[model samples]
Target: MLVLFLLGTSSSALAKGQKHTYWHLTSDAGEEAGKEFESQLRSVLVQAEGTHHTTEGSLAELLDQKPLKVPSCFEGAKLCTTVPELLVEALGVDGLVEGRISAAADGYQVELTLYREFGGTPKVVTRSGADLEGVVRDAVGALFTLEAAIKIYTEPAGASVFVNGNLVGESPTRVQVHEGNHGLRLEKEGYEVLREDLTVLPGEVREYNATLVPKVTQITVITWAESAAVYVDGKLSGASGAPIDVMPGAHSLELRANGYRPIEITFDIAAAQRRTIQLAMLKEVEDPWARREQAIRTYRLYVEAGYALTLQSIGFAGATADIAGSTYSPTSFGGEDRASLVFNGVKLAVGYTMERLGLVFLGVDLMVASMDSELILTAQDTARRESAVGQGASHIALYPLQGTFRELWGAFGAEAQTGLGVSFDSLNGDLTGDAFDLSQTAVFWSLAASGRYYLSEEWSLTLGYRMDYDFADQRGLRHGFFAGVGFNLPLLVDAGGESKDESLPEQLEEDVPVEGTDVPESTLQKLEQSGTEGGREP
Candidate 1:
């Protein structure tokens, strides 16, 4: 008959108890007596909440099938001294209890050995009494439970601790534990859960300490862009303004904005480590029209000096010497004379650009240009005298006024300038037989266009074309091309007294170490100093 007993304990509490299982090996006692002793031991184990198994097969059958080789006895008689490990393996149990009955001064003697399945010697228990059944039952009941004491603590002092999936009191406390292997866990809000496996020894007190790491890691991402989206690995995290958590490892970071080229950076961080990163996104170059509009918004101050070659010709009306008193006609100048009109000159300009007004810049430019030209003239029919109307011409001087509009596209640029000003001209040559000087000052206007390529951030090479027309008509037109370099100076202040780029926040502040953290003090200080320095610099 199957018997059941009720021990008034909660099922969960019973289930939480340490589990023990053992096999009862056939004893060397008389078969009837050994069977009776095993039955009594089995009843005791069940009362202790342990599960037990007994083999019904013959000993010869069990020994033949077990994989372990049997040690030979000297006479080849089947070795009666049982190897407990072999019996335990044959029955597939955690441990085995084997007993032998023998003659003694008392009515009988029962010798029992508990062999745990793992490595080590067996535990021997002996009982000498009038009845063997009572002694075996008493010996088997005491071996079911092994007890030890364990004290656990954490750095932060209040972490909830657990053993074998059952919560104990908060850490920094000691608890009685069942021996063998068990799982230990410590947990708290805002900290990583720490789980470990521990082996306990019976009648021993063990001490354990754990340092909990933060569950969230703080990482500050900084960029020179406003409202730019940030990406960690491949997923979009947030915009440019806040600090966020990122997994500690190598990751591809990207910054994206409407008019700026997306910036990509690769970075790494350690576990529980804090850091700051700075990103600089470049402006995307668009069509020339858009570039021109952008350049007008912010331009710099510069001084440019270059060499120019002008092709110019002068025309004059001379009095005819027929029978009339001063009849004038236009003089016809030939190719050689036109060749002599070509002049080499130098140009220097200094200018300041004001704040942009819409798409145009309002500013003034003072420019100086000089050229020397030879002119040839003759009087008709009569011998000309110095006191009479002059006969030949010589040199001329000119001055011009201009305004400028400039645009930059990455490393390349273009400019167009037009304005009106005044010019002073002096002409000198020989009249008939002597030297002569003739001079005039006239109003003039000029137009110029230039293409520039920057060789560096502040220096550029330029090619230009210019035309100056004299309003008096006689001076004709002076037009030519030039090549030169230009440079810019950074000012201490702008139209708003400060550059907009300077107002952007630099490196973000480093994450501060939490109180009671296990991070080294020197490391935290180093991170703080590095963040301060980065924020101060570009």
Candidate 2:
């Protein structure tokens, strides 16, 4: 903190022999926080009427970039640098000031010090709040955050509260406590419940914002009067006197009243989601009706099934891993070396998309390949074994291993997709034909840009460009254009049933002429059925 002020030795104070002043100050720049010493002194001497005893000092980091407000995202730790003692001596003043910061509740504070000229005891200054600007008006934790403290609040207020697994407070005079993250819960009898993660910084006041998510329930033993106890994820959310508001996502809810058959349902909650569930109290069925209803639910799900579609692509490639050994064969692959090895195509796909959070999606990939190659191996002292096998002859071995690293290996991020969703993509792949199939395949990877325009719900137009190493027949960059029809596979989604989208062929039925005339039906059949034959409209 840097303040420009002017002060003079008070004659009345001097006469009374009480002239030691307690002063506080503030600075606008983070790097020059210590610059306050000289700045304040200069302001007092040049800007104010000061004459008796004067002191000036600086803070720790004189040239560090200010810490960004984005918390841990953009830190200012790098901007901090130390100044030499000579420079501090050059601006000889009464004292130097220094301090460090730690979070409290809603804000942060710093413990400052006033250094003496003779290296005497330092003056300790403590600011206690988020609003503390300086010691002049003044009066002041390295905390690594962990579990965050979530705030809990009622729309109106005065709701009973609970924290971590226990009952804590009631609304209105709700106690705001702790500086850090924590599990929180808030509830009210007969109201929806709230529970969430909370992260509060030291010296910061946090809110555990809980709102009731309404749900249409089937807890009624009887139509309009029965009240079921609402449990969120197997725990009591408020006493379910009415539909309670709960945050959306996956949750297990049980509605049990004494006389009513206990009913439990699981569902996913979304943001700002409002659900009105009417508990349809059902009468105790004999046997057949209950079985019939269960059967209907299962049958209906089968009828509403959607279609399946697959995206396809084809490619030819080759490559060579050149060994730097003295006695090794330098082989090449691609269009130059014509052989039985051909890469029909490679495909990656995801299927069975539902309205869920990618729960139903299953990713798959296929590679169509046939290749033959001979490798020079040092088996005998003077003679090398040339192992040549037929194309598509090698058996593929499957080894699936999952490994976790302390650091992240891959990530998807883009500045353009910060808020809105439109973005760009790139990908590459490389393969070695045999040992050295350079003439056929060289590029191990390729990059492609694709733009899609959906003209209608049933169809879309796609355009793409790829800049890649020539692996097919060792060709440089072979550009290609493609246009294809996109249709839903309604048959695939059905349980091996006839596709509704495909109608019966009309050409299957044929007309025959009678022997005596050109009529389509016989005289006997004409009496039994309609005699005239149908003709195409011209």
Specify the highest-lDDT model's number. Answer: 1
Supply candidate 2's per-residue lDDT for 478: 27
Clashing pairs in 1: 394-428, 395-428
Task: Please provide, for model 2 over 251-342, each residue's C-alpha lDDT reduced to its tens digit, 9 standing for 90 to 100.
Answer: 77666654334556666655455554433322222233332222221211111111212121212232322333323222222323333332
* lDDT (Cα, tens digit) per residue for candidate 1, span 326-363: 22233433323222255555556655543331111222
CA lDDT for candidate 2: 0.34
Stretches of candidate 1 off by over 4 Å are: 1-299, 316-340, 354-401, 492-538
TM-score for candidate 2: 0.20
TM-score between candidate 1 and the true structure: 0.35
Q: State every prediction's TM-score relative to the real structure.
A: 0.35, 0.20
